[model samples]
Target: MGWARQKQQHHNAAFFWRYLLMASALCLVFFTPLCRAGAENHRNAYATMMYMGTPRDYEFYVAIRVLLKSLAALHVDADLVVIASVDVPARWVRALEKEDGAKVVRVENMDNPYKKQANFDKRFKLTLNKLYAWSLVDYDRVVMLDADNLFLRKTDELFQCGQFCAVFINPCIFHTGLFVLQPSMTVFKDMVHELEIGRENADGADQGFISSYFPELLGQPLFHPPANGTRLEGTYRLPLGYQMDASYYYLKLRWSIPCGPNSVITFPGAPWLKPWYWWSWPVLPLGIQWHEVRRQTLGYSSEMAVVLIQCAIYIGIIGMTRLARPSLSKLCYRRSDKSTYLVQNCLKLVAFWCILAAYIAPFFTIPHTVHPLLGWSLYLLGSFALCSIAVNAFLLPILPVLVPWFGIIGVLLVMAFPWYRDGVVRALCVFAYSFCCAPFLSAAVSKIMVALQLTFEREAFLPRLGESNPPSGFNKLY
Candidate 1:
């Protein structure tokens, strides 16, 4: 009985082993294609890191590290190319080495001696002449990124849009903040040769040179996305979040409320580094204030106030032009003839009305309003005053020839209190206060007062003029 039981156990054990082998084979057959597919996908994914130099400052290094970390989080395998005069720090190299899939290549001896004086070199680390030369290094596609830039999202999709010699779209070409460039050693060499020979010195920067020459090289293959796509036609530009318009906020006192988080921000002239007085505080604070108020009031009163103020200013300036028309015409032209004065006044009125019509048409036609009412009103008023001054200057030759010195004064005042300048707010406030204190504040009030004064002047002066006008001959004198 013991021998029979042992033999039966051995037979069962062999059957169980055979069943396990068959199941293992079946599992491999089912999963092999999936494994292969995954491997193939891994092979297809390509990524790269490109930096011009080892950033000299801590902030820039931190930004680069942040960019790299973001790239890694997206499962992209990247190779870092550093174009620098000095070697990368040992610690940075070690840290990057420990990173699973990062490689760093140092390209030496490319520093520009004129970097400090040359804006192009200071910004791009290369002159227009040398850009093509440096671009000759080997890679499938290279992304040139400024050291200070931070990448918040995966850019792998940028690669999916087929390769071009170079691809970028901004208000201007050669943003260089972030751009994808295809590999071309020959083009790079040619660009370098051109740079060395000063072939691109006239336009001022490598960007200008590239813009001028890229069309010829690429034969319409180079892509330049427009600022507004519907107004143009091409690939939808990189989401606004991808490139923030930093200039409006940082450098200029212009504010824009982005529609969404993904809106690309582009800083012009490094606004974070240099903030503008008018735009820096007012826009951010006002935006926050409006956001809070919007929730409670369900209305944009502040914005409306700003727009109304702007409109009021515009209307006031137009009124001022009408009030000052006679004096301006007399001062602009020396001709005493009523016919000449009438023609000059008509021309001035037509010009002013045309400007007004053009300015107001946009507000009614498109709902795309940026400034609040008060702000817009102020802008229009200031614009009208300035335009009136300009038109008067142009007409001064034909009419009442005042001392040219007044035109210079006008120019200085316009410059000192320019609509776009930081000082404009104070100027506008002063003007508004003056207008409020005027004896005849409204147009009707002013016109009535002027008419009464004119009636009194005519009664007092007409009898003397009639009695005195008696000289004979063609020239009758009063």
Candidate 2:
């Protein structure tokens, strides 16, 4: 009996050693970079696609600038980096660079071969651009944000969290909008590998990909330390306060600590109904706050300057094109004909005029300026109100479709003259919206709308693009 027991003990000891060896190797693999960069600068930034010169991209750009200001407001001033696409407008890129504490890091759009091979354009809505977070190695840690998020208070303590820490958004997932991460090329490459192997999440973007990558993550409890008493290389759950949604604004007063921070308020409403939807504020919660953010980050004068420059450049481009190829005038401006549908032309004309006005009004603040507000407000609210009475009582099912259609089509139509005009400008604007902004917003809005009906979806937003200065004509604003 003693001999048999001794043999069994020896076998158990060997197994324990093997497990220890593996665990140690993992620690070395993951924690080495974290240790080396422990004293380096950390960053807080977001990713947003900017191509189409659309108002949405402008708003997000302003949001990033404001976010950096908010960080400085809390005295947690660190490097503010914006990872953007290669062809984003020079104006937008320069505007970001001009911000007091912001830097724009341009990156190429990384494609998911699996999504393309599967012909899953609609299904593959989440951006692969966010994978660049792994490559932001200059900073020891990074707090990646969705440009739409508003910081209610200081959140500097987030840096104290582990390599991968996020809030448990649902029973099965964690919020990505505001998370603490120690950027690692190793982890980033692993994500790319997963994508190459056709392992994608149902929701498409980073959240699902991240959740799937760290399956054991859901088990980690929030507001509690890990079993080992320190943050390890693996995934972790952050406190609820780190990433709260709009619902938290009222609910948090009761549960959140009286003076805690980040209490990061995520605007997870329908994409079009954002707080700063200048024309309309559907939720009636913080529409004013949204505008206030715009006001803070992009001053009235700066915004005006940007608009005037755009108008001048565009007018010049149109003039130059017509002069260069007289025949192109026919394509640039269509003759008024009875065949033109009244409704379509009216809306298109209204949009065209509105773009002109949006650029012009910043130059001269006139009483009639309020007319555009009234008109646009009527349009957006009327549309939302009319749709509110749809057959289903929950929410407009087509809200998702309309939001994206507006951005995609709106962008294309703005430069409808096609190659006859500034094709470089048009391509950049469209790509930013289609590849980056529109896709992310559509998916988020679709998810958020459903969550509102079922459960308010708490998730993160990632900015995924790169950019350099645009051409000389339109680079005056910054």
Candidate No. with top lDDT: 2
- Scored by CA lDDT, what does every candidate get? 0.42, 0.54
Give lDDT tens digits, candidate 2, residues 281-306.
22233455655655655545544554
All candidates' TM-scores? Answer: 0.40, 0.51
Task: List model 1 lDDT by residue over 162-184, tens digit each.
Answer: 33333233534535455455546
Cα misplacement distance, residue 378 of candidate 1 (Å) = 41
**Model 2 worst lDDT run, 10 consecutive residues:** 456-465
Instruction: Give the range where candidate 1 is weakest over 10 consecutive residues by summed lDDT.
Output: 396-405
TM-score of candidate 2 against the unseen true structure: 0.51
